[model samples]
Target: MGIAGVLEDARPAAAMVVVEFIFSALQIFIKLALDDGMDVRVLVAYRLMFGAAFLCPVAFLIERKKRPPLTVKVVTGLFLCGLFGITINQNLIVLAIKLTNSTTIVTALSNLTPQSTFIVAILSRMETLKLKKPSGRAKLTGTLVGLGGAMLLTFYKGPEMKFLRNLGHTGLSHAQGSHQQLRPPPAEGSRILGSFLAITSCFSYAIWLTIQAKVGQVYPCHYSIAAMVCLFGAVQSTLLALCLHRDTDHWRLGLNIRLYSSAYAGIVASGSAFPLMSWCLRKKGPLYVAMFGPLIIVFVAVMSSIVLDENLHIGIVLGAVLIVAGLYMVLWGKAREEDEQEADEPKAKAVGQDEELGKETTAVNGES
Candidate 1:
């Protein structure tokens, strides 16, 4: 490939790394805000609102010509996407952070996306199950292994790594390193409840991915679709927050950590991350996009330990390794299948050309 071609591919990969780093930082920020007593619902509402506002004008400016008229079906799909992708996922994530810690949440999220999405695709018939093929078997096994790893991470909290035991905070906190519990009163039940919520959120996110594929096929405008999803997500989350949080105290956002967290989550994670990921998805296939998720786990593990004072547990490390291993197995299998298909294309074309030549010769013989 030419230098220009190499640069073109390099850009998206670089962008994805930056996106993961931003997202990793966002997790810590969200934890900080919650630790500062920001209600999860209220936090979600503000994040969605800010994200929607950020994206609306950009979508209007760039995709106005390409944007299609909104049909009821498209609108409904967008609504569902918001409900599952933004509202449920983010809410559960915050709650999980409240219950457990950011490192655990990131570990659960490490390599589950592809496995969950693949399972959903098979059930929905969006992806075929070719059991005879090695790719199909590898995907199946990998999905199981990934799920098992997540389960291990949730159920098993081994002793902290000895080397990382005495590490100090990375000074990401603003309040003189005071780490207070900002979550609900239930502390003992956190591990069990948090694990369930985290796993459920993964499933909900997978469903959103399946629906997004269908929506993309119909609308085909990435920015416009993202804007609509954010708009609807803001409305849904706000309503939910109002119903649950009647106390205006929880919604108060002064010039504190709460305000900063909401701003970063909105502008950086939601608003900026979505469009950037969408562009990467378009440029590099879903597998390429999925390959970058493990990077979040690495970033989160190191950052969480330093910033949030979270322990680096042996179980988390072991489970993360298994999850990533299974992820690569599935990706390698799919890549091999794609390569085989590409290799056969030339032979198929050659056969077609030969048939055409024989027909032409027969026609000439008849003419003679």
Candidate 2:
């Protein structure tokens, strides 16, 4: 391949890493911004609306020339993607964040997407089963390891109140009351359930990505498709938020830092990221970009610790390492497969040329 081809391949990987970092930080920001005074449902509604509003003009300006004709088929696909990807995914994710820390939520959930993508793609006939290949085995094993890590993160809570040992040395005794008020009481069972819900949300997102891959092949206009999906999501999410939060006080918008956080999530995380993700999927394939989801967990861990002043527990570190290791295993397997395929190409080409020459010679002999 030429230098340009190498750079082109690297671009999507680099873009996805940036997207992962932004997405991870967005979760931590959202968690910090959430308060008992605000309704989670209302926040979801605002995010969708603001995200759509941010993307609408850009889509119109850039995709105007290449826009696919609006048809029922395209509209239906966009609506479904919007419903699953935006509405359900964001709702469950925010609810999970409300129940748990962003580190746990992002870590467990992000790890599930690749496996879910594989499963949904296989079921939808978008991906093939290759049980015979080492790469296939590695992907399967990596997925299982990731799930195990998630389970360990969710189910196992280390010894409770252990921090009391260092209370005197750290001068935590004086700040006990304030710390208690600042930290939400931990609910192990509830948080485990929330983690499960987050995993389910990841599955829904994976299915959306797999379906969108096929849709993009047919439409080839990422901006238009993503804009329409966001618009539909904004409408649906707004109605749902209104229904869930009937009190007018909850609907009131205020000029605050939380609003700024919402704007960042809407404009940068959703609006810009969504279309870029679609374009990357079209150019690099689903597996290529989907592999970066696990990195979000690391970003969330680092940012949440810094911003929220959360402790970097041993379990969190171990879980993060396991998730990264599993993700690398899956990506390594994919790379090996690509390498093997590249090695076979020349032989396949030669075989095809030989068959074609033989066919032409046989045809001439028949004519003679």
- Largest TM-score belongs to which candidate? 1
Task: For residue 154, give model 2's deviation from the true position in Å.
Answer: 1.2
Clashing pairs in 1: none
For model 2, name the residue pairs that clash: none
Per-model lDDT: 0.81, 0.73
Model 1 compared with the native: what TM-score?
A: 0.87
- Tens digits of per-residue lDDT, candidate 2, 59-90, equal 89998988868777777888989998988988
Model 1, residue 158: C-alpha shift (Å): 1.1
**Clash count, candidate 1:** 0
- Candidate No. with top lDDT: 1
- Stretches off by above 4 angstroms in model 1 are 1-9, 173-176, 180-188, 340-368
How many clashing pairs per prediction, in order? 0, 0
